[model samples]
Target: MAVTQFNTEAMEQCRTTVSSQAGQFGAIGDGFSNQYGNPEIFGKLGASGAVSSAVSAMDQAGAQEFEAAEKVLRKVESALDAIQTSVHDVEEANKNSMRAV
Candidate 1:
């Protein structure tokens, strides 16, 4: 395949992965709001029950976001690798074509 074509394909794939991760982060943010919001409710629920639980809940939400970001970053790295490979392939192909000419 041509270098440009390969790069385009890789970029499209990476974009898809990033879009998926953005949605995941959005969900995690929403969950954090629901699980740890409302100071009045937090006070009523008591420390051991809901108040203390917010710590764990927030941690879990942060972990989810981190995982999603990692996933998206990996995809970007993969895309870069693919582009490099494509460039190498095109260079080799050009050398062969020059010999034929």
Candidate 2:
């Protein structure tokens, strides 16, 4: 069987990048709402409600996507750790058996 090696550092970096992107999107949404989404401005356009709704939807979607990706990565990391432990245990058992012979 081919040895399975998990690049934990790379996975962690990917998770951090996704989290940072999510945070950046949230900050952008906040800034957009505060700057260009002024009630007075949107009211003058006669689409204040529609604009606010769109912004909220985008923010929610981004958050959900990031959250899902992070969860998957966490699960993968957990599985990798379990596999490593199991492999080590098997190796130790084999060594003990050989020493007894």
**TM-score, every prediction:** 0.52, 0.60
Q: What shift in Å separates residue 65 of candidate 2 from its native position after superposition?
A: 0.7
Residue 81 of model 1, lDDT score: 63
lDDT of every model, 2 decimals: 0.64, 0.61
Model 1 score (lDDT)? 0.64
Over 1-101, each residue of candidate 1 has an lDDT whose tens digit, in order, gives 65444455766666666666656666665555544445565556555466556676776778677666766666666676667677778888988888542
Worst 10 residues of 2 by lDDT: 29-38
**What TM-score, to 2 decimals, does candidate 2 have?**
0.60
Write the residue-wise lDDT of candidate 2 on 1-101 in tens digits: 99866665665566566556655655554443323333455656777878866776776666566556656655655665566567678878978889543
Model 2 global lDDT (CA atoms, 0 to 1)? 0.61
Error of 2 at 24 (Å): 11
